[model samples]
Target: MLKSSLNKGLIEAGCDEAGRGCLAGSVYAAAVILPEDYRNDDLNDSKQLTPHRRYELRKIIERDAVAWAVGVVTHEEIDKINILNASILAMHRALDGLKVRPEAIIVDGNRFKPYNFIPYTTVVKGDGKFMSIAAASILAKTYRDDYMDRLAEEYPQYDWISNKGYPTKKHRQAIAEHGITPYHRKTFRLL
Candidate 1:
């Protein structure tokens, strides 16, 4: 079972990002500040849940959480600053959007820059272990998925609807055949 949070009484926000590995499109991150007493057995890593379940849980998380916000860093920015920095910046941006500031932050991965001088902990696989991080994962994944779905309409040849801009065999083939889109991260290995 995922724990509600790392800190018991403090207002904690969980941070997570999606699309850091994608070859195209923007990276998205979410900051979720759930109530300290919240609990949901179904919540887990966004990756562990199906797309349908993630979307469903998104509604619940948004409705029940004390506050939640999403942030994005575009492919162009990713190319300029690199994925790691962009991912961290996206998390900071998410925190910027939160209506309720957090007293602490728990991040899903092991790397994060300090945000607003709040105390923080970086868990290697926090999404699978903490409810707020899992919720943030769901929001980030679903939001980025929706953005990619729209991009798929613009560049159907890349099959982003299927691969979501990951470096899938088909996606790489599309890059070989048609070249990169504005959404492609030029710094990434496209082929």
Candidate 2:
């Protein structure tokens, strides 16, 4: 079962990003604030769940979250700032869209560039440990996957539908065959 919040004493938004390690497409992030007592045994790390389960959990999170938002850093921006900074920027953008300003933030990774004066804690693999983070992970993953699937329609050579912009063998082969697209991260080494 997933714990509802990292700190029950304060309003907190859980933050996480998806597609940070991808060779193409944008990095997506999500911030989700759940009630103090929310629980779901089906909740886990988004990567650990199937596409069907992630979609189901995403709907639940969207319906039940006190406030939630998603952000994206485009491929050009990712290449300009590097994936790490782009990930952090995406998180900041997500937080900017929250309906309720949180007292604190619980970030899924071990590093964050602090959002304004609001306090934050970075827990490695937090999605497995906290419900809010898990919810954020599901949102980010599903949203990013959906975006990539749409992009796949325009660039079928990348096979984004299957790889989801990850560095897969077939994706690399496609890069070698067709060359990079406008969506591919320029700074990333395709080989």
Screening candidate 2 with a backbone cut-off below 3 angstroms (N, C-alpha, C), the clashing residue pairs are none
Winning model by TM-score? 1
TM-score quality measure for candidate 2: 0.98
Please identify model 1 stretches exceeding 4 Å from their true place: none
What's model 1's TM-score?
0.99
Overall lDDT per candidate, in order of appearance: 0.97, 0.93
What tens digits encode model 2's per-residue C-alpha lDDT throughout 1-191? 87888788799999999999999999999999997787778889999999999999899899989999999999999988999999999999999999999999999988899788999999999999998999999999999999999999999988899999999999999999999988999999887
lDDT by residue (tens digit), candidate 1, 1-191: 89998999999999999999999999999999999879899999999999999999999999999999999999989999999999999999999999998999999999999898999999999999999999999999999999999999999999999999999999999999999999999999899
